[model samples]
Target: MTILENIRGPRDLKVLDEAELDELAEDIREFLIHAVAGTGGHLGPNLGVVELSIALHRVFDSPADRILWDTGHQSYVHKLLTGRQDFSKLRGKGGLSGYPSREESAHDVIENSHASTVLGWADGLAKAHQVLGRDDHVVAVIGDGALTGGMAWEALNNIAAAEDRPLTIVVNDNERSYAPTIGGLAGHLAALRTTDGYERLLAWGKDVLQHTPVIGQPLYGSLHGAKKGFKDTFAPQGMFEDLGLKYVGPVDGHDIAAVESALRRAKRFHGPVLVHCITEKGRGYRHAEQDEADRFHTVGRMAPRTCEPSEPSIGPSWTSVFGDEIAAIGAERPDVVAITAAMLHTVGLTKFAARFPDRVWDVGIAEQHAAVSAAGLATGGLHPVVAVYATFLNRAFDQLLMDVALHRCGVTFVLDRAGVTGVDGPSHNGMWDMSLLQVVPGLRIAAPRDADQLRAQLREAVEVTDAPTVLRFPKEAVGRPQPALDRVGGMDVLHRSDDAGVLLISVGALAPVCLQAAELLEGRGLGCTVVDPRWVKPVDEQLAPLAAAHRVVAVVEDNSRTGGVGSAVGQALRDAGVDVPLRTFGIPEQFLAHGKRGEVLADIGLTPVEIAGRISAALVRVRTKSREEYGR
Candidate 1:
C-alpha cells in the first residue's frame, strides 16, 4: 500500500522514507488543486505549506507540542494530514471551517484566522509551558507578511525577553503576506531566501587553503584576506544574530528533505531560533502564480445558493454596496477620496481604483496607518471614507478613538462584515464592533438593514460636515428592503405599535430579524414594535421615551450581550427612572463556531422565533404581576 493511503494521522507520517515523503507531498498538492478549485478556499497559501506541514507532523508530536498558525489560511495542509481529507464540504454551512478550528481537530493550537497575532499566542504558550514544567515545544509558523504588524513585533520583543524560552518560531518566508511584505525586516528575510549555502562552502574552502603547502598557502592566504570584504558584500543579513536568534537557512522550503533537516535541527535547539524556509506563495499552480493579486487569498462566493452559475458575483455583497455608494459620493463631492488597508478587492473598491486612480489609496495591510492618514486627509479639507473589514478595524482602535473620534474628524468609516461572519469563525467575526465602538466619543455608528438604506445612510454620514461617522454592514446579502419610518436621533423606526408591550431594537444589518420577530410576536398575541436604531451609539434619546411608554422592552442585536447597544438601552431606561423590565437579547460571550449565518443565529437564539418567544414570555410574567398587584 502507498504511504499516504496507509496514513491515518501524524503518527503514520513519521514512518515514511524521504522518497515516499516527497511523493506524498506531490499527491497532497494535486489533491489541493482539485479540492480547492471545487470548494474555493485559500488555495495558494496551503499549496506553499504542503512540505512544511508534512515536515512539521513528521518532526514534532502534535497536540502535546503545540503548532499555531498565524493567519490560519496555511493550515489547510496541516488539516489534511490530521484526518480532514474531506474537502468536498469545506467552508459549506455545516462543513469544515476555512481556518483552523479547535473543535475540528486536537492539532490546531490557536483558532486564529486573522493575521499577525500568532507571535503573542506563541509567547503565551511558551511561557505557560515553562511555568507548568511541560516539556512540549510551542511552535508558531508565521509568514513574512505577518511580520509587518506591530503586534507581532510586540510579541517578538516578549519572546526575545525570555532567555531560555524554548520556542521554535518558523519564519515561513513566502516573501509576501497579502501583497508583498514591506519594511526593513522583509529585507532581512529576503537575504535568507537569496543567500543560500553559497557563502558557507566558500568559507570552508578558504580554511582548506591555510592547511596547504607553502606555494598553495601563499595563494590561499591572499584570497582568504579578501574574503571578509567579499562576504560582507554578498551576505544579506547581519541583524538576526543581533536579535539573539540562531539564524538558520534560506533553505528550499519546497524540498522536503532540506526542510526536514532544518526542522530537525530547530527541534533540538534550546532557546528561541528562527528557521527561515523560503517558499513561493503559489508554488505549483500556474493560475495562482499568474494571479497578480494575493494568489486567491480568500475566494469570493463562487456558485449561487442552488450551486449554479447565477450567483451574481458573490451576490452583490454588503462590501459592494459600500464601494459603489462611496464611489458615487466621491463623484459628487470634489473633496471626497477613499482609503483601504491593502484590501481594495475585498472591500469592493476596485471600481473606485479604476475610476479615480489618483484619489484611491491602497495602504499595504496597515490599518493604523490607514486611519491616522485618513485623519490627515480630513485635516486637509477632504472627506475620506476608510473602507475596512470590521475585524481589521480592531487593529486601529487607538487611532480611531484618539486621532479620528477624539478630533471629531469628518471621516466616514465604512465597516463591511459588521456582525457574526460565520465560516471565518471567532477571530473574523465583526460582533464586537458595537461594544468597542460605543466607547468612541462623538463617533456616530449606523447599521443599514438593506442595500437601499446602506446607500442613503452612507450619503448622510458623508454629508455630515462636523463629526466622524461609521456605517456598518454584514458579509451576506442586504436582504428584502424595509421602508424607513422615521429618522429620529439618527435612528430608523422600522416597525412601531401604539399598544405595544415589547420594543425590538436592532442595530445595523440585523433589522430584518426585528421585522420578522415583530410578525411572530403579532401571531403570538403580544403587541410588538421593532426599532432599527440605525446609529447604535449616542443612545437614541427617542428610544428612551419610547421605552418609558412600554411596560417591557426586549432589545435584539447581533453583538455581544456585554456592553453592547442592548445593555446600553437597558441601562438608559433604568437611569431615566423608567420601571420597565428590559430583556437585552444578543450573542452570548463565547467563541462562536462555523455554520450558515442563519443556522448560527438560530443556534444563538437570535432568530425571529426565539426573539418572539423570549418577548412573549416576558410579557406574560409582567401581566401576571400586574394582575396580582391589582387584585384581579
Candidate 2:
C-alpha cells in the first residue's frame, strides 16, 4: 500500500523511518500537486506545508491536542494525512472540503479560512483546556502574511500575557498570502530567512547542551541565553521573545526532521512559544512556484481556448466586466478612483490598476480601512468603487455603517462573490451581505441576475450621489438572464402563468433557480409566476399585487434565511395586509461546508428540484388549511 493510504492518523506518521518518511513526503507532494492542479485549490500554501504537516502529525496527538490553522487554506496536507485522501474529488460537491472542517475530521479544530484568526482561537482553546483541567497542547500554525491582521496582534498580546502555559505558535513563513507578505512581520521574517550558518550553529549548540555536566550545566544555560543573541542578530525575533513567548527557529520547514525536532523542543516549553518555519510556497510545483501573485492561490476552472468574441463566453467575470467599464469611465472622469483590500486580482481590478497606476490603491488585507478610505475619497470629491469580496466586506461592516452610510457618502461598493460561493468553504460564502447591509440607513443594494443587468446596475450604482450603493454578484460567472415581463418600481416580472397559484419571488442568483422551479410547477398544472426583485433594500411596489394574485408567495435567495431579502419582502407584504402564506427559502444560519455552488444550493433546498418540491408541498398545505377552515 502507498504511504499516504497506509497512514490513518498522526500516530501512523510517528512510526515511519527516515527513508520511509522521505518517500511518504514525496508521495504526499505528488498527490497534492496532481489533485490541486485539476481542482485549482490553494496549491502554493498546501505545497509549502507538506513537510511541516508530516512533522506536526508525528509530533502532536491531534483530536486531543488542538492545532489551529490560521487562514486554514494550508490545511490540505493535514487533511490528506488525517485519512481524507479522496484527492480526485478535492473541492467537488460532497468531497473533502477545501479548508479544514470540524465535521470533516477530528483533526480540524477551526473552519475559519480567513487570515490571522487562529492565534485568537489558539488563545481561547488553550484557556478553555486549562479551565476544563485538560492537558492538551494548543498549536496555531499562522502564515507570515496572516500576522498583518490587527486581531493577530491582539491575540499575540494576550498569549504573551498568559505565562507558564503550553501554547506553540507556528509562523509558517512562506512570504505570501495571495500576494507577497507585506508590513513589519514580513521584513522581520525575511531577516531570519536570509541568515546562513545559523542552522549549523543551532545544531552544534543542541548537540553540546545534551552532553554537558556541572560547569557544562552553567555553560549550557549561558549558551542557551547567548543563542538568543545569535538568533536576534541573525533573525531579530526580539518582538516575540519580548512578548514573553520563547521564539524558536528560522528552521528549514521542508526538512521534516528539522520541523519534527523543533516541534518536539517546543513541547518542553512551559510558556507560549513561537516556532518560525521557513518554507517555500509552491515548493515542489513548477507552475505555482514560478507564477507570481498568490501562485494560483485560488483558481477558477482552466482558461478556455483562444476567444475572438465581442464579450466573454464564460467571459471575463462581472468583476472584470465592472473593472473594464469603470476604468473606461475613470479615464474620462478624473475624480473616479478605486480601492481593494489586498484583493485587486480577485475582484477584477488588475486591468484598472494597470491603466490608472496612481488612482488604484492596494491596501493590504485591511477591509475596514478600504471602506473608510473610500468614504474619505468620496468626501474629497473623488468617486471610489471599493471592489472587494462580499465575504471580506463583512470585515468592514461598522466602517460602512458608521463612516460611509452615516455621512451619506457616494462611495460605491462593488462586492464580488456576493452569494453562496462554492469550493472555498464557509468563510468564503457571501451569504450575509444582504442581511448585514440591511441595517445601514439609506443604503441601496442591487443584485443582478445576469451579465447585462450587472453591467447596467454597476453603472447606476456609480452614479448614485445621495447615499452608498452596494452591487452584489456571485463568485461564478453571470447567471441566466430573465427577460422582463413587466418593469415595476425596481422589480422586473420574469414570468406570470395564467392561474398564478404560486409566486416565486427571486433574489439575485436565486432568479434562475426560482424560474426553473416555476417551470416544474407549470408542468404540474399549477399557477406559478416569477419576479426578479433586482434591488433587495428598497422593497418592490409590485410585490403587493403579485402576492394578492398568488395563493402563496415564496421568496428564494442564495443568502442567509435570517433578515435577508426574502424576510424584507415578507415584512413589506405584511405592511400591506397581504397576509398570504410567505415562505422564505434560503440558507440556514450556519457555516456551509465546501462543495460545488449548485450542490450547496441544492443541499440548502435552493435548487429547482428542491424549490419545486418545497413549493408544491407548501401550496398543498395552504390549500388544505383553507378548505378545513371554510367547509362552504
Candidate 3:
C-alpha cells in the first residue's frame, strides 16, 4: 500500500518519518491531479495546499481543535487528510461538496466558500473556547488575497483585542484569488515576503560583535535590548506585530517540516498569532503553474496530460455574450467604465479590461468597496458597471442601496451567474439577487431572456442616468434566441393565442421553459399566451391590463418565489384592481443542494411538464369554484 493509503486519519500521520511523509505528499498530489481532473472541482488550489494541509493536520488536532479555511475551495486537501478520499463525484448532486459542509464531517466547520470570512469565524470560536475555559486550539487558514478584504481586517482588529486568548492564523500566501492579489495589503505582504528576519540579523551581529573587543559587545547589547524598534526596521512584519498578535515566520509552505515548525510555535503562543507561509498557488501541476491568469483556480472535466476539456463547447456562454456586448459598448460609450472584485475574467470583464485598461478597476474581493466606489465613479460624471456574481452582490447590498440607490447614482450592476448556479453549492448559487434587490426603491432590474435581449437591455441599463440598474443572467450557454411575435408595451410577447385562458410570464432564461409549458397547455385544450417581461422590476405598465384579459396568470422565474418578480406581478395586479387568479413558480425557500443546473431545476419543478400540470390544476380549481358560485 502507498503511504497515503496507510493514513486513514491525522493520528496515522504522526508515526510517519520524513521520507514517508514526503512520499505521502507526493501520493496526495498524484491522486488529486487524476481525481479532480475527472470530477472537475478546484485543482490548483488543492494542489498548492497539499503540504500545508499535511503540516496543519500534523501540528494541530482538528475537529477538537477548530481548523477553519477562509474560502473553503482550498479545503480539498483538508478533506482527504480527514478520511474523505473519494473524489468520484465531487461537486455533483450526492457527491462531495466543492466547499466545507457541516453535514460532511465533524472536521468540516463552516461551509465557507465565500472569501474572507474565516477570520471572523476564528475570532468567534476563539472567544467561545475562552468562555468555556477549554484548551482546544483554533487555527484559521486564510489566503493573502482574502486578507485584502475589509472584513478580514475587521476580524483581525477583534482577534487582537484579547491578549490571553490563544488563536493561530495561518496566512496561506498563494498570492491569487481567481486573479493576483491586489491593493495595499498585497504590497504589504510582498514586502513581508522579501524582508530578511530581524532575529537572523541580530544573531549574526551578536556572534561577530561578541568576538570583538569590549566596545563591540556593549554596542550589540544595546541593539538587542531595543529589539522591538530594531526588528521593525529590519522586517515589514510589524503590521501584525503592531496589531497585538505574535508574528511568526515567512516559512516555505511547501516544506512540510518548516510549516509544521511554524504552526507548532503558533500553537504554543498565548495570544493570537499570525504565521505567514509563502507558497505557490499551482504548486505540483505544470499546466496550472504556467497559467498566467488565475493559475487554474477552478477547472472543468479535462485531460490531465494535455490540459484540454473532455467535452466540446455547447456554444457561447451567457458570460461570453455579456463580455462581447460590454466590450462593444465600451467602444460606443467612452463614459462607461467597468469594476470587478478581483474577478475580471471570472465575471466576463476580461475583454473590457483588455480594451479599456485604464477604464476598468479590479477591487480585490471587496464587493462592498466595489459598490461604494461605483457610486463615487458615477458621481464623478462616469457610468461604472460593477460586474460580479449575483451571489456575491449580497455582500454589498447596503452599499448598492444607500450609496447608489439612495443618492440616485447612475451605476449599472452586471450580475453574472445570476440564478441556480449549481455544482458550486448553495452559497455560490445566485438565486437570491431578484428577491433581495426588489426592496431597493430606485433600483430597476432587467432579466434578459436571450443574447439579443441581454445586449439591448444592457445598453438600456447604461442609458439610465438616474438610479442603479441591474442586468442579470445565468451561468451556462445562452439558449436559442426567442423572437417576439409582437410587443405589448415594455413586455415581449413571445407566444400569442386567441381565446387565451392562461397568461404565462417568463423571466430571464426561463422564457424557453415557459414557451414549452404554453405549448403543453395548448395541447390540453387550454389556450395560453406567453410574454417575456424584459424588465422584471417596476412591473411593466401594460402587465396588469394584459393579465386581466386572461382567465389565469402564471409567473415563472429562476429566483426564489418569495418577494421575486412573481411577487411584484401579484402586487401590480392587485393594485390595478385586476381580480385574476395568479400562480407563481420558482425555487422553494430553502438551501438547494449542489447538482447540475438542469437537475436542480427539474428537482424544483421548474420544467415545462411539471409547470404545465400545476398550472392546469390551478386553472381547474379556479373554474370549479367559479361554477359553484354561479350555481349558488
The C-alpha local distance difference test score for the whole of candidate 3 amounts to 0.89
lDDT of 2 by residue, 239-298 (tens): 887777766676778888777867877776666878888888888777677767777576
Q: Compared with the true structure, what per-residue lDDT tens digits does model 1 show for residues 387-480?
A: 8998889889999999998888999988888778876777878888888888887888887788888898888889876788988888887666
Candidate 1: how many backbone clashes?
1
Off by over 4 Å in 3: 176-226
Q: Give the TM-score of candidate 3.
A: 0.92
- For model 2, the superposed segments whose C-alpha errors exceed 4 Å read 132-134, 176-232, 299-316, 496-502, 523-528, 549-551, 609-632
**TM-score of every candidate:** 0.84, 0.84, 0.92
Highest TM-score against the true fold, candidate? 3
Name every residue pair that clashes in candidate 3.
none
Candidate 2 or 3, higher TM-score?
Answer: 3
Better model by lDDT: candidate 2 vs candidate 3: 3
What's the distance in Å from true for residue 349, model 2?
1.5
Q: Give the Cα RMSD of candidate 3.
A: 5.9
Q: Which ten residues in a row have the lowest lDDT in candidate 3?
A: 176-185
Return the top candidate by lDDT: 3
